[model samples]
Target: MEFYSFNKENGKQITKFNSNFVMSRIIQTDEAAHIGCMYLDKNGLVGYHQAVVPQLLLVLNGEGHVRGENDEYVRVQSGDAVFWAKGEWHETKSETGLTAIVIESDGLNPSAFMKLK
Candidate 1:
């Protein structure tokens, strides 16, 4: 329904659309998959949340950190891509502004944004 736009909710920094926080429309309901791009500003944090479908984090620029439901974190830099499973609580933290592409697709994949329950 809604397209991509700036996101500042979740205790995170402002996320730009298309250039930063851009997500594709959901193709499947039962599967709950979505694809999009994202950016994280310095000291930005996206509070814990779930995904509608499986998420693939592709680093486009800058550096940052991602926190999972397990409280585990992974260091990320440009040209790096990470996979975040759907239905799993996760959060993103950035020290400096970061730009990345997020792909949410596949029937087996669901975005935490949709399935927050």
Candidate 2:
């Protein structure tokens, strides 16, 4: 078993459109496994990037769009599921009235990225 935690200011470390959000790490693996929860404002946009391990994005709030990997674009909404292939370039863009959460159970720790400010 592993322990992880997150504070209100932590989510600000990773924001969308400069909106305020919160984050929490529900689980973590001894090696390099972790989960993340996030909130994005309407029309929010997350930078484009890739990861060493594939990730899954589950919409827990409103709706949005995800673009990356060979210029592929996917639309997602609450109750929708998106698969992020490992090392596949990816970015997030939200239209008006959008919010969502993401999970990266790879080699990322919430405490390492959390922003206390």
Candidate 3:
């Protein structure tokens, strides 16, 4: 699988709302959304499974490996974002540990802002 990365370092600095931070655009869903924080410890894993809806995993801390239908793992670290369409098979694992934000909805369209790596 190919890599997909989106870090705040690549985002625009916010001068309109505030001047102290950079904002990385993740997703904008018009439908109802389910957002949650996920933590994977050393040797942790989120087993291969089909996505119930359009899902976006935004890495917030540490690093990990992720795979889609091909079963090939792609390295991901802080600022990386992975998207899986509804019914797509995917898995995530980390040798060390990682923390991330997961956003799931039917209207997710990450390509609007995030570039594939």
Candidate 4:
């Protein structure tokens, strides 16, 4: 068993899509799976982008809104989970700050597992 925690003082600060956020990598495997924690400050925004791989965001604290390519926004709060499929465009914004667990993998293609023999 392994234990993990998000340490703000130690997490990597990343700026992308005009947003500033912190990420703490919990686990990353050569198999293309990644698990991490992300922190977004109040009024923080993650600009629209497409997911190269499948991704899941599990909200742990605070409130936020998620928008998809269609420009529709959905309210998200603590305990909410959102998923984005590969190549899906999405964005997020935090009105009251947000903390979330993120899981993603490049190996999530279901077509790759089809046995067409």
Tens-place lDDT per residue, model 3, 3-64, is 45678666778888557777777778789999999999999999999999989999999999
The TM-scores of all predictions, comma-separated, are: 0.58, 0.56, 0.91, 0.64
Question: Compared with the true structure, what per-residue lDDT tens digits does model 1 show for residues 1-117?
Answer: 112222223223336663555343222345554556786888878787887666666567888878777776777776555556657677777988888877676543223333211
Residues 1-117 of candidate 4 have per-residue lDDT tens digits of 011233454357888887698774433335667889999898988889998787767678998999777867888877566767888899989988999988788654322321111
**Candidate 2 local lDDT, 1-117, one digit each (tens):** 111224342333447788655564322445554457767777678878985575656566777877766576677666554556678788878876565555666644433543222
| Residue 17 local lDDT, model 1 | 60
Q: Candidate 3, overall lDDT?
A: 0.87
- Residue 88 of model 2: what lDDT? 73
Top-TM-score structure, candidate number: 3
lDDT of 1: 0.59
State residue 48's C-alpha deviation in candidate 1, in Å: 1.0
Off by over 4 Å in 1: 1-33, 107-117
Off by over 4 Å in 4: 1-31, 107-117
Using TM-score as the measure, name the better of candidate 2 and candidate 4.
4
